[model samples]
Target chain A: MEIDLQGIVVIVGNYGSGKTEVSINLAVNKKRAGVDVKIADLDLVNPYFRTREARSQLSEIGIGVALPPEEYLQADLPILSPVVAGLIKNPVELTIIDAGGDDAGATVLATLADAFNGKSVHMLQVVNPLRPFTGTVKGCLKMRNEIETASKMTINGIIGNSNLIDETRPEDIYSGYEFVKLLSQESGLALKFITVPSNLMTEIDVSRFSCPVLQIKRQLVPPWKKAVKLS
Target chain B: MGKVLMKGNEAIGEAAIRAGCLNYFAYPITPQSEVAEYLSRRMPEVNGNFLQGESEVAVSYMIFGASAAGERVFTTSSSPGISLMSEAISYIAAAQCPAVFVNIMRGGPGLGGILPSQADYLQATKGIGHGDCRLLVMAPAGVQEAVEMVMMAFPLAEKYRNPVIILGDGLIGQMMEPVEFPDHLKSEPSNKDDWAINGMDTRKSTERNLVKSLFLDPTQLNDNNLILKAKYERMKKEEIRYEKYNTDSDYKVLIVSYGTMSRVCKTAIDQLKEEGIEVGLIRPQTLFPFPEAAVRETALKEGCKAVISIEMSMGQMVEDVSMSLQGKLPVSWYGKCGGDIPTPEEVIDAVKGLNV
Candidate 1:
């Protein structure tokens, strides 16, 4: 379960598979681990619930967030910030690129292939078994092939981030772990880690998981809730 | 079959399929484009038809065609796209064909940002298209409600032979929530044999059924409008849906809101109760058959100081609130437009200002 928490890590997944949540928590975890972390918001597909929504919170913690220019920040057009290319070319202790959802969202990564050529990138496919299209092993494999073909980058590992938001139970995490374990066996990709909501961490037994357990403090919430303050 | 986590857009697409709506025609627009994206793959699996029309104008006509043929059909689009579809909406409404339209609203008078906004309140409730046209409009507060409303819309549209609208904002279409497709809501399209153009051979009738909105004679046009008026009146008698929160208490401020904005008001109401400031909320689930009587009665409750319309629009629903009150009580408005939803704290501030 010793994941190499270094180099450029690109996170990809199906739409609504909690990719942005995993990306944000991973960057925060790496930052607390005393590593210089800078994350890029490369999501151009979804108009809402992207990494840029957490820009102020992430910036408060000294984690650099690269996003599209001010005018194009809210636009859905596929405009990648030049700073993303710069982040990919230069190396920090940990650089995370949060790609958009599905093959359509991941297609933007193919445009940055030149920047990622020389670096050792760990492209992890985040699988939330509760989400549509990735609920089965066959569906997970199909998504893997599509994402790999679309991004022109091979996935090296899997990040299990299964939950039904507030309705998630302990069995969901255990069953999600088992589901992703089966996916790793079928796809021959390593299981890097599994995520549990920080509130539910006490209910879950981490020893059941063979990989490291990443506690996710839910950041991307509905507008009505108090703004997430990640200390 | 079982409960699963899904985005509102995907849940709406599945709900239509479960409701036996086999035909879906749409032009992609955010943040509701996922409905088209989801149905494109799902429709074929169920032996249904999914078509991406060239534009919203074309898609709206496609809905008209399928509905006239006595088939269950629907389309999903955002603000500007719905504006494009309004012409056909008028045609379908006048033709008395059953059709369902889901407008996952984005901010706009024209081409506004693709963030969540309830700015289309007036457009949907009062003036959707030209002429005397009214749609049975339902608004949902969350994803599960969106699914239920989408499922109910088809049957309601057929029941009255008029177009039905599901009015949601971008957040309702984009946010993720766990939803269950109730087995009871799975329904077959009601018998459309009476007036549908289902071909002479199919109906086993020698006469052809003509479906058209044109009434060249002035008297005939007036009769047509009368029939439409009767259906709208029946809807007002039966379909005025609203949820009252904290109204049991002697509240000072009565807040009228709908869609996602209402959820924020609910949170503000709960927080205000803890601080000893009483605020009540009326969340209208149906926008067209607005809960007028309920709002008026609640606004006249004991210790009620004033009524405020809280929305994501620039005071669109306030007019409806004013109309409902009929000048019996003072009505005011507070909101933000172009995608910055008022947070619970901001809503609390607004409510406290009313108290002061």
Candidate 2:
């Protein structure tokens, strides 16, 4: 298993689109590969279940984390920090910017227009075919344009994060890969990766993915798992 | 368009782009509104981000969110908005996130008038948070300085991993002048994949990554604070930036000032020089980790009678001057508040009152 997307890779989706879960899993996967990694929790748009929620585990893996400023950690007014600019201007390989959801969440990307001037900064939009505004190609385009407008950056790539969590199937990823391929051709967005549940990976033909396949483990424990032993 | 005359606010926007920063987040505010207005259109042309947030509070946090994801984010506001951002600024510092804050200061206790003022001197330089956090505060006097400081701030913020403030008054924000943008040299933003929470992949099988600012254990917190303090101390050695005006004379009066007040002091010093009075000025560019040693040395050598601290506020910077002098010189303080700028003539009168 190799999560090779290096430096900062921003994983963004519409609200409740499992963007944070992808981000958390990505950081851990990369860190486990013996690569120096860091997870910056920039999801100030949402108050709960941000990447910072698992700071203890991330720190345990020896991966650095730069979260929203301490004062507004709970306040949640729109968490753009100066340190973000500093981080961009001097990135430490694999600097993943987990943007806010939709155009509104993507709006924070505009504040980084200065730094993105030259770099082929890959802007990826995660599409969950199951989610509304993403079920059709037109909706995807609109979401894409909105993200571009708000981020003030072009959408260079797409991630198929189509899943049903507990009920995720290999078929969903294949259909998603096909759907976004049409989108990539129509809208000029390269289908970068297809994400699936780790439990579902063995069932899916990994070779079918022309792009990379990211097997994500659920970071959150179900309420029932709360009573389980640590070991 | 060859160098259109621009206000300091407009220059901030232009300079940000020139500094290789195309992203700007801000909400409308009196006096400094031009920053948002200018960047709103300019950003798109450069393929940059410009968003008018719902409020100053939201706007600053938007900057936080953007910056955390590793981008050069900035937000502009007056005193009130800055006050709202203080909490976020502290977080940015604690989290070691780097971004720029443009504060076009205005006079006030609450909802101060939309006019030029430098009352936020204390707030800008001093730690804005409860924990141990010190920001790199840059005070820009003119539109040129404002633009230059903003360009400089990007690198400074990255170098120290701290927030930098372009602490300007409303006058600088509003006043128009000819300006030149920097021939920005592009540099790669560091490789922070180790900490940037971009996405999960299969190749690297692992649990999850977290980014936060909470240290529970008392000893651990203390250790973290010590590490932060050491970083600040290193900054004092490496990033203590300033500019001196006419200090080469056998001047008895050393006028200590910054931002717009420094310009006023410059004018005052020139007039005094014309009148054959020996008066010099020490203008600090970096307000935090201030040019304390420089001012103290000037007062110490040749027996300068007074080091007068002039500001747009009643006397925020005077405290720095007082601390720096430490009984070596009688530190006099003079200034008006609430957008009332003292003319050069009045400043001379202040110098004469000291009778140095």
Candidate 3:
């Protein structure tokens, strides 16, 4: 099944909930599918393991990456590049904004309220049950409210991104899907999609889930791994 | 609980709790503030105490106070925060209090960038504080090892009745990995009655317990230093831990690296072997004990021509590498400290350039 992700997608989630990974993979997936894709890295809360780490990789594949200026690339300041607002305003086939973790990180989006005004925005909350605050349905709902309030945007969808990194089992994916399904029912938000690592794609029976499955290539790895160098 | 993917900083906070350390005092710093964040929510669940001190200086003394009261206590901080805590760390050592300090090191010397760096090698191992003070330092390569080391640190600190340091780089604190905490490592605080100022009634001893770092008498101070010196000496004998990789092969270069840098070197070694070049590695799990005999023996291997200390620092660990070799072989340094970790290919190129 194809992912119907288009028109100003803002990915927000709790800390360590795989928001950056989901944002990167979603951009790549849409780009390869012949859509004009651009992504912005607004992760000022974290100084490491950010979407900009994969900037060159995205650019090599003909996807535009909008982040801070070169001088402030490594700085943990909440400085938004003009290109981000420009990208959102002009409206590409698919524009993904990888917001930072939690309400604190999402606060940056409120500053861009003028750019996001009157836009058809799909603010999706990437939920990883394995993380701390987003573990339970109540916790996930609480995070949704906090992120929505902080970003000045409502979370219209949920993205199930549950895995234990390299140790992810097929059962984990199935259970994670069920957890998000319950979350969708409780919160009245559509389950936009669920993510399965590219390595575990074949191992998992994708037919079991009715939602679109976004196969995640494990970016944002530790530096020891063969990683994409920061540009 | 089953294994879960967790950032190293969060896992460390949980590991301390699992290890029965219920008291946590810390000040927030990048790449490691997640530890304090995790504990702030978690400590309340377990009815444990978690306090964010006004500053790292105050936090270290809070650790000292809790540890002196016979409570298992620990703190996490970045490079500059650790510098502020150094004064109290020395006092804790002098007073013989068991406390754990986790330094998720960022680039350093001053307020360096928040990216990963191992430049705190000299600071952690040699000059943590004033006087002839030394801390037992353990370096973990990844999240799993980080969890295991944090769990082991409490017991080890109490065993020596001194402070222990878990030296990790920013990558270790920032990255997520699947970790399963060992159930057996959970332990209760032991031997606190002998020295801790818990309570006179609790100990039921006629004499009250006293905790003080100041022995104003010159002879008394000398005796205290001697006692500390003897403890460090005993640590060298009983606590030296290291791992040797590809040593049995006729490797030409011996790389002494630790923490995350060692993992990069390991990958380089594998790639070099594929290209018909043999390179061995000595990774020090414990930085303090230095693993001198291990390095000396590994470097003495017949075909090993030279040694290199590959680290994120300019050349801090190279001194220990040279001292370990005792001038038996040439030693060099190869690394980057400006927050960029050397890639495995770069490490392979460095190894190939040795021209052994």
User: Quick one: best DockQ, which candidate?
Assistant: 1
Tens digits of lDDT, candidate 1, A114-194: 999888999999999888888999999999999999999999999999899989999999999999999999889999999
Residue A8, candidate 3: alpha-carbon lDDT:
92
What is the Cα-based lDDT of residue B169 in candidate 2?
Answer: 81
- Sorted into a CAPRI-style docking class, model 2 comes out as incorrect
TM-score of each: 0.98, 0.59, 0.96
lDDT of 3 at A120: 86
| Regions of model 2 farther than 4 Å from truth | A1-231, B200-209
Standalone chain B TM-score for every prediction: 0.97, 0.93, 0.98
What is candidate 3's lDDT per residue for B1-356, written digit by digit as tens? Answer: 77888899999999999899999999998879999878988999999999999999999999999999999999999999999999999999999999999999999779989899999999999999998779999999989999999999999999999999999999889888888888855556768886788778867567878899999999999999999999999999999999999888999999999998998898889888989999999999999979999999999999889999999989998999999999989999999998999999989888888888
Cα deviation of A189 in candidate 3 (Å)?
1.7
- Chain B in candidate 3 has what TM-score? 0.98
* Evaluation by lDDT, superior candidate among 1 and 2: 1
Task: List each model's interface RMSD.
Answer: 0.9, 26.2, 1.3
Candidate 2, residues B1-356: lDDT per residue as tens digits? Answer: 22334547767887888777767888877667767766875688889988888887788788777777767778888888888888888777767777888888888768866656888888888856667888888887777788788888887887776788888887777655556676874633463333345466521536454455677888877886786788789888887878888888889899888877777778778889999998888888888888889889977878578889988888889999999998877888999885557888889999999976
After superposition, candidate 1 runs with Cα above 4 Å error: A1-3, B184-187, B204-207
lDDT of 3 by residue, A1-231 (tens): 999878999999988899998998888888888999889998889888889888888899988999888999988556878888898899899999999998989998998999989888999999999777777999999999988889888989999999998888999899999999999999999999999988888788888999999988878877566543322
lDDT of 2: 0.74
True contacts kept of 2: 0.00
